[model samples]
Target: MPDAPLTQVLAPDVSPRPSACPGLWRIVTARDGGICRIKLPGGVLLADQADAVADAAERFAGGVIEATNRGNLQVRGIGADHHGLLDALLAAGLGPREAAGDDVRNLMLSPLAGLDPLMLLDVRPLAAQLLRMLETTPRLHELSAKFAVQLDGGEGLAMLEHPHDLWLSAVRLEQRTWLAFGLAGCPAQQRALGAVPVEQGLALVRAVLERFLDLARPEQSRMRHLLDTCPADAFVAGLGLAIRRDAAVLAWRRPASRAKWLGVLPQRQGLALGVAPPLGRLTPAMLRGAARLAREAGDGSLRLSPWQSLLLPGFDSARAHEGLAELAALGLLCSAGQPLARLVACTGSRGCAKAQADTKADAVVLAGLLHQGGPGSVHLSGCPRSCAVAHVAPATLLARAPGRYDLYLRDARLPGFGVLRATDLTPEEAGALLDLPTEHLDD
Candidate 1:
């Protein structure tokens, strides 16, 4: 339970600006019902907090919990009992320090932040400081809800492709660690704008945010939007921080992470079991069972990953197989090779009015078809919004109607779901096309 009282914690000058995105206080209405997003600090949720979410969903919502791409969780189909749901989560220490801080708490960190064996530094302390600053600062709350930051400790299991408004990656310089940063992009594909000493990470973040707020207009809500008018170099120059932008910083690229998000993950001291709720939707039983496993077999906490999965960290190596079995029995995809594990879909016509087809149902059917062919990562979008994934997928099926879709294969040179290969095809047709070898598709 949280130390803060409900009355004091629940009401904190919450005047969030208008946005389509969901936040704890801002329950955006959806086709199904109201949606309340819970932003986890560093994506860490305690066993008891997970229980509170499960209970709240079962009581106040339709029992559908979604793992967001940003390593956060959102309860969809919430009923009139939004206040009741919020209170339950607040009691579980899930809410931000203040209501105003809820929307600005959009920070991404690796699920294996402190435990990854290959990490250059443990960034938990610095991440915590940044989170606190976001929460406590009144001026920062004026920033848009979509504004986000990423802190990478060089974890081998980190999500490298997700673009953030501001991203800081750990790099070594002269045998000392520094933070390589970029604007409006990710570490995997984008070059770092500059770098700062490890100790100045927090200062650098503050300066950057202040500079953005100082320069951006009301219409310019995101870093990318502002960058459309202001050059990247000019934006960095205004940050007022001593940033290293030499050849070494500009040339450094984040190593491609081939690590899988499922199965038993290697840790510094112990093993962590990675599991995902099928299609990124969790039932109450699944959430409770995972929380119980975290308490019984691993650390008493669950870390949400950007892969739309969960990691039960600090578990004994001997019980890895046992834990994997438990998660599998809970209907989670424990292996990356599972056809369903590689498929991502957003809420289609069932939840969003903009969706032309039921993307979730189609993804399930497509998964079965691709099982034998071993398809790569595929994304099914209800519309052009592409809400389910932040990065470009190997394959994309954009819905045109109830069962028809436009198939696209990712092309670096082409924008907007890459190059469209076929239009107005059924899921079965798309499945057959996707099963073809890469050489055949490229032709």
Candidate 2:
């Protein structure tokens, strides 16, 4: 367990390497207020815990809660009562097992880890072990707060674009399950660096982390940084594990999941309902209502998604539609076809000093304009930080001023929000151009 109250251990001056990111212990100040991030295990939140979070947001903060793109929840606009908020959340069992563990517990699993109808292996058990090691091992706690690991079960509803420090994808070789892994990238963008037998996955992870800590300099906080200097082959050679770098594993690619995150989601045994609070911000009332609905109509748990949405798993298939209506009434986007469902926006000038424009408000306007054209995913960023979406969006509206934006279309050959299509256009103008066929954009 953590040695002392997180409030004491986490004073800004105490950390050997202080992080700007918000955690349970470190409530970073922002333009709006202090932000306290609460990480969820495999993105699961119990119904009771949901209500507690809602209460804490209303009682101790400004009642604004955000579902992060990484499948976590953060309380925004926190006031002086940081202790009161932490106490409430800890009481609800939201804090990591050890207070020092809070920042290191960044293991991402598919939102439908065990429940997905199309999964190669159930990764929940392995994820549990990995999370425990990350928390209980004091040596591993030295890792950066942003260092993350992803364990993919080959679920059809998985988020494949978000890069991680270390990622493992399930694969079958001669009818035997194996884990193909890559460093510093997502499965979709990069080929597997190597493969290990399923049972050897844990040992491989431990060795890789230890190796990284040994070789990485202070400036090389992420895997990509280290890889820039040290060859990946040399790093793998020292692992001392029998890795399969054979053609079969090297040529393997993860199939793209075109599955919609919102609406009635098919499950292995039952059904799940996916929902998103508007612009990734949840009101206290909306949260409490979702909790009440979870308790009454579905399983007593909710799962957060990388899409900045929530999922109510284990719901009765017959009653899933009813739950969808209830969720919609609570102001959640409950369908794939909803215009707002395809838009992601960061907290702009309203809450972030770095922002030049109100991205959230702009996103709302863009959504209305895109309503007639059908659903197309877009990201609105107030700055280059791009806090809202980890993966690149199909189209990006980079804000230059209060209402002007530079639009970029996703292109494989181009980097950083893709190729720039237009410079300094209003949302309405961008909408008109985006409405045209893809071939017309280049002209």
Candidate 3:
């Protein structure tokens, strides 16, 4: 438990390390108003907590809630009454156990961490221990708010592209489950540095964190930054843990997942229904409706996914389809075939001072244009920051002006949004080009 009471810790005057990112207590001002981000443990939100968030957004803010790419939720368009909002959320058990822990509670687990039929191991227990250690350890509060770790259970529905400062992935070797880990990258792309027994997972995590704090300079806040100076091999060698660097462990790669985030999804025992808010923005009614359905049809809980979506797990196989229909009726995107589901956009000029165009509005127009062609997923960014997505999309439309963009295609051979294909084109023009077949667009 934290040394201070919840009320005392959430006091406005309790200053934490200054950062631009918003936390439960730290409301960062934006063009839309102050934004308050509420981090969820393993992205799980109980039905009651969901109701509390919806109530807070409607009562204190503009009722504009956003599902972040990191499987967390943020209330946007906030007005004054930050205290009132914080109080409501804290009372609902949305805030961290320790106020200082708010910034450091950045462990990401698969939406189906324990429910996936193809998972190598159920990572929920180890994930809980890691989260608790991160929250209670005052020394670890020094970690940057943006610093994050990922625990992969080898679930078929995991998000494997988002890079983390430290990533631990489940791998089987010699008929035993061991955790293969990498630094500053995701399991889908990076090779493992070594492996440790499943029972020693907690010890491995603690040693790695302590070693990082010992070696990292103030400027080197992220693992990638530190690794630029200290080699990854050197960093691993100093962890002082019994690690297996055998060929089998080093050569193991995470299996490719064909799991989809929208519509009905298969679980180990039952079915889970997935839905998304168009453009990742959820209205108060939308959230309240989902919460109500969660209570009636599901397990009274919802799991936010890395794809900026929601999953209602533990549903009876018969009721799952009906639940999906109810969610879709609430204006949620329940199928990938929905044009808006295939498009992602950041808060554009309307809500962000740095934006040059209105991306959310433009995405609607672009979605209409691509409806028939069904070109793969496309990301529309108001600027170069690309705040809406952690990984590159198959195609990108970088906003240049109010109604124009620069288009790029993902290419493994190139970096930073891949190859620039066209510039200063309207959404209509970009859609026309994107509607072509893959080979034609590449040419």
lDDT of each: 0.89, 0.87, 0.89
- Give the per-residue lDDT of model 3 (tens digit) for 1-443: 64554555457424379888888878899998989999999999999999999999999999999999989999998888887888789889997745688898999999988999989999999999998999898988889899999999999999999889999999988899999999999998899999999999999988888888999999999999999999999999999988999899998998977798888998998888899999999998989999998888888899999999999998768788788888888999998877788889999999999999999999999888875436678899999999999988889999988999999998868878989999999999988987776852321
Q: Which stretches of candidate 2 lie over 4 Å from their true place?
A: 1-16, 372-375, 437-443
Q: Candidate 3, after superposition: displacement of residue 59 in Å?
A: 0.7
Candidate ranking (TM-score, best to worst):
3, 1, 2
lDDT tens digits, residues 128-183, model 1?
Answer: 99999999989999999989999999999999888899999999988999999999
Better of 2 and 3 by TM-score: 3
lDDT of 2 by residue, 78-155 (tens): 999877788788879997635677888898889999999999999998888898889888888889999999999999
Candidate 1 wrong stretches, greater than 4 Å = 1-14, 439-443
TM match of model 2 to true structure: 0.95
Q: List the residue pairs that clash in candidate 1.
A: none
What C-alpha lDDT, on a 0 to 100 scale, does residue 89 get in candidate 1? 84
The TM-scores of all predictions, comma-separated, are 0.96, 0.95, 0.96
lDDT of candidate 3?
0.89
Query: lDDT: which is higher, 2 or 3?
Result: 3
